[model samples]
Target: MKEARYFYVPNAVTETELPADEATHALRVLRLKEGDELFLIDGEGGFFRAEVALTTSKKCVYTIKQTLKQEPTWRGGIHLAIAPTKDMGRMEWLVEKATEIGFNKISFLDCKFSERKSLRVDRIEKIIISAVKQSRKGWKPVVEPMIPFHQFIDNCTSAGQKNICHCYSEISKLDFFTEANQSLEEDILVLVGPEGDFSFDEVRYAMEHGFKSVTLGESRLRTETAGLFAVMISQLARRV
Candidate 1:
């Protein structure tokens, strides 16, 4: 088996000092000794194979030898936009699971019906780092804090197919597979609503902005579940 990979928030492929927290993890928690070999990732596909040169309870210093890049599997990159859950743990779970499944971007939206209105990007970043290392993934998903529904929708381009997961009755709900193509390589974004679902105005706004309505499964899902469900569906569609 390969040595476990760890992501450093800041490290110099040239001569970068590992972040204080990550240094503590390596030196104290993991008990890595000087001259031990390990892998370091930046979460954007950049990787380094390095050897620890010095270790202290508060820090671990390493000398990086080489750089490697990992390619993302999805043909068209995957981005998931959703409302954040009021509970921090639920949102953290979303970040971890989505990172493991390979989402390039995640944006939190503030909708009319959104229960939670704020988020801490730094905390989310830590969760993502842990998830990437645990899942043996080199790339880290970009996590954006809460933005207004209108602004978020306005910024999205008509590049690849844009879709929304809403619970509206008027909208035609189809299994993600039906609308998704096997040859999909275009940038794809899926918008998931909150616990109470997107407000009528929000749904209309997304629809007017070129987001087609879609469903993940029969039962209703929470905000985080819907977001991850979209990630899973998008990954599966890409592989088909």
Candidate 2:
């Protein structure tokens, strides 16, 4: 049997046809017609086996034939918070790889040394949606806009398994893999600094607010690389 085409559709329970963008792709690009088989990913851990019921100039109406509740590959959520690189293309690549590797959320940080000030998350979200479908992931990762470093740390005070990857020789640090391995079934959040690295004050503040200082490794990594590494470690740790 031929594989079914997968489309990301959110809140499609009561909806009849694909959204404007998805519809255009289905109609013009894929040339999907009535009676074609498709899989709808709701981005909420739901996989619906559906049949094309009807097709209009810009619509792909579908009737769900089966509902599959597939479990995520990893055990708990992995939230990667990083200071986005000045070159957004690097961040986009990181987000794509991290999504394919498995992560739940990604947040941009505006650190004291951060080169990039503002970011539009809509484009990043679209990359995430595409990655979800490409990777056949059960859930879609969220892309949050950049927030001040101080505010980001403060807000995560109550988060479970909070860790920060930094290179502060004077400051005591734990290995991220070791720390993450201990909390297999808990939601983990990791903070990666910018290329310029986190300021002493910022690192100190985060440490004071329950964010454990951790090191990714001895080798220095770029901001995007650090973020992707954190996500990869979190995903691997959870599977252990």
Candidate 3:
């Protein structure tokens, strides 16, 4: 079985301290002693395989024994920009699952029909950290704060495949999965709307900016579900 890993804010090479809660868990709950092996990850980048040199009720100190350059598992890149669910718990769930499925970036947008306008980044960061460790991943997704729908679309820097998963009544010119040709490297950005869906104007704005509208499936999924669905579909498409 893979060893349990934990995210430490700073790169472990320099002397570092774990957060109070994490310290308590590692030293007191886990009963990890000096010279024990544990993995440390700097959320920014890189993984440190370290040997715990000191342990106390309040702290666990380690000596970095090895360093591994972290890389994404998927050769293809996937970024999902979606509206946050009104229920904060559901939003957290989305972050966890999407991280496990290998999302490179996640952004929140305030669409015309969005009901929840604000989000707590501090709490969301904690959730992402937990999800990254849970999935045994070396790197975490980049989570951006809420942005206006149009502004988010306009700021996209990726020149590869761009798509929007919407259920608008207009007949889509092409399905999202079919829009990208196999010759291109696996980089894609998929936009999903809020509970009430994107306003007609926001949809037009995205289309004008080269975000092709495509459907996830015939069934209408909730905001979080649609976001997850898009991640799964894109992952599969890249493999094929």
Candidate 4:
């Protein structure tokens, strides 16, 4: 018996040949040959069992043998919107780990004190795709482009539990896990601040926009750590 290989194919149904990047991996890295079994994920909750139908120096074609859809392990939606870190590596690590842990969406914020105002989501998306394939996740997390702090807050008008984590001492906040609604199927959104943290006014604005103030723990955490911490807490709260 042979182990199964997985590839990211956006439209596996209508497409026969793997995407250029995937083809390169299949042909050069993995050296997949004709009739070899592999799996495909569309990144939109579609999983497929496929077999290599043809192999060429520059092309790898596959035929869908069976559709293997996977149900999400967790309930409800987990959304984390945070200011990107100054170092791209840290932010990239967060995206990769968060995808492996399972989350529905991620958004980048441009905060007043943020060190990095702009980000290229393309590279981050590629990291996410690789993580999804490695983790065998059926759904891919949506990475929204970086938007202004106020604008992101204003647009969060959905009917779900919302929260903001900040480092302000004077402000009162509940423990994230304790404050989060325990109902597994409820939608949840958590906002994490940047390295310099969200300004007092931004925190106030988020609160005014229906986001509750929450705390991760006693130990101070960096921007990326806080973001990942929030994601973990949100997912854990739903399990109780």
C-alpha lDDT values of all predictions: 0.80, 0.88, 0.79, 0.91
Clashing pairs in 1: 12-16, 43-140, 76-185
Per-residue lDDT tens digits of candidate 4, residues 13-128?
Answer: 99998999999998998999998999999998999999999998999999999998688777789999999988999999999999998899999999999999898999999999
Tell me the TM-score of each prediction against the true structure: 0.90, 0.97, 0.89, 0.96
Residue-level lDDT of model 3, residues 1-240, one tens digit each, is: 635656554555666656676777787777788777788776656788878788766887777788877765555678899999889898899989988877788989998888899999888888888887777677778889999988898897667788887777874646766654443475888889989988878887888898887887778899999998888877777653
Model 1, 126-212: lDDT tens digits are 888888888867677888878999999999876888888888788777666666654497878888888889888888888888887
Stretches > 4 Å off in candidate 4: none
Which pairs clash in model 3?
none
Model 1, runs deviating above 4 Å: 1-5, 9-12
Clashes of each: 3, 0, 0, 0
Query: Which numbered prediction scores highest in TM-score against the true structure?
Result: 2
Which wins on TM-score, candidate 1 or candidate 4? 4
Which residue pairs clash in candidate 4? none
Runs of candidate 2 with Cα error greater than 4 angstroms are 1-3
Residue 172 accuracy (lDDT) in model 4? 92
Model 2 lowest lDDT segment of ten = 151-160
Choose 2 or 4, whichever is better by TM-score. 2
